[model samples]
Target: MSNNGGNGGGSVLATFEAGTQGWSGTSLAGGPWSTTAWSSQGSRSLQGDITMSAGSQHYLLKSGSTNFTGYTKLRATVKGASWGSYGSGLGVKLFVKHGSSYAWKDSGWVTISAGGLANLTLDLAGVNLADIKEYGIQFIGASNASGTTAVYVDNVVLGN
Candidate 1:
């Protein structure tokens, strides 16, 4: 076994395997997150849903844990569903807690046309990883349109 240790107690923060632990929202008409094998949530919207495929939706893996003050990274694999180009764009947001609220610190957007995989990595060198208790992944609809779309998210791993 590989020995991966770090300042966060040398423990794995969170790991999301495909067809395994993840979150989804209400089954929309041909919704990608609804049909896939991700975990299910009840929240659905006309502009896509933000479901946690593995961990808690409101709180990420490192939430409430000691602030990660060392080298850290956030990685994930994502794909979008067919809702025309309306729901093909998705975004990931990183948040850090300030006082009693979480704030959006970083965000990355990806488009999945023709159904392919996109890998995303965010470096958390300067950000206060320790204060981050919650993070979010959101599916963005086509600009200037309002409707439901589907997306697939998997392989969310955080490490040092």
Candidate 2:
């Protein structure tokens, strides 16, 4: 999928093949989430696992200051396992930095089917791309699931 990491009309923003590439894993909502590396599309993939669980656990992979001006979309190849139910258990979202003081724009929500690999894209058409600081994935509605929920991320590329 994704033309093997090709962004169709734009240059690749990041591949994360160089060891996280300034991105870091965050256990949001104090969820028992941890990160590890595995193989994806013949390269290394970052895997986020909910090793433990709290009610409504949340987690994110975040980093900053990419200057993504002019880019209108973000593409990410991912796979999910467990993640509870689509509505009440495990859900995913894409967010972009907004304005000068580091606010966030909730770009869109991604649907994660249990144990499925998906190539998903998000629109960045309306945001102030000129002031973009960063972009990342956030897990939402993780309350009903146990520690078995996991998401693997790879080939996260930004494009026009």
Candidate 3:
């Protein structure tokens, strides 16, 4: 996989084709374990049931060909489910790795508390991508909070 041109003028390095069913079977770097979709704590939300469990369900992505030197930007579009009292509420955590056995460090988290859609972005300003071996997206929430909350994610892009 190659890094996408910062100006949005190059080919895609890698992409997860989330089908209508809301789940993708591919791994981060052709790994063995399959990354599951989003999970809910209660009834299934309308945003499309793609969620993680209270603990598991973290998805990893390898940069492959793209390596960053300076500032980089990552963005994604997501739709939250309209279930429960607050509807489809969720939080996303971003992580980055520097080496093969290195642990994933938290970059940031974006919370979606409404029933509508929201756009999230994070700036990798001082991160060193040279040693970044893998990046991950994890869902964090409480039990009884309706793990069945649905979510729709698309158009994940990175730039430098």
| Best model number under lDDT | 2
- In model 2, pairs of residues that clash are 56-143
How do all the candidates rank in terms of TM-score, highest first? 2, 3, 1
Among the numbered candidates, top TM-score falls to 2
TM-score of each: 0.52, 0.73, 0.53
Per-residue lDDT of candidate 1, residues 79-157 (tens digit):
5445443333333343334234564554455544524446666666666666765543544334433444345554444
Could you tell which candidate, 1 or 2, scores higher by TM-score?
2
Q: Whole-model Cα lDDT per candidate?
A: 0.41, 0.60, 0.45
| Model 1 lDDT on a 0 to 1 scale | 0.41
Candidate 2 at 94: error in angstroms? Answer: 1.6
Q: How many angstroms is residue 61 displaced in model 1 relative to the true structure, after the best TM-score fit?
A: 9.5
Q: TM-score of predicted model 1?
A: 0.52
Worst 10 residues of 2 by lDDT: 28-37
Q: How many steric overlaps are in each model, in order?
A: 11, 1, 18
Query: Which digits, one per residue and each the tens of the lDDT, describe model 3 over residues 3-113?
Result: 342435422323343322233322112221212333221122112344444432435344432464543765555555575333334566555665556645654767667
Candidate 1 residue spans exceeding 4 A from truth: 1-69, 83-101, 144-147
| Candidate 2: tens digits of C-alpha lDDT, residues 1-160 | 2345446766554455556555666763233222344445556666665543434534455565556676788777666665444444456666787668777776466556567666767788777776777676766544444545566677677776
Which portions of model 3 show Cα errors greater than 4 Å? Answer: 1-66, 69-71, 83-88, 100-103
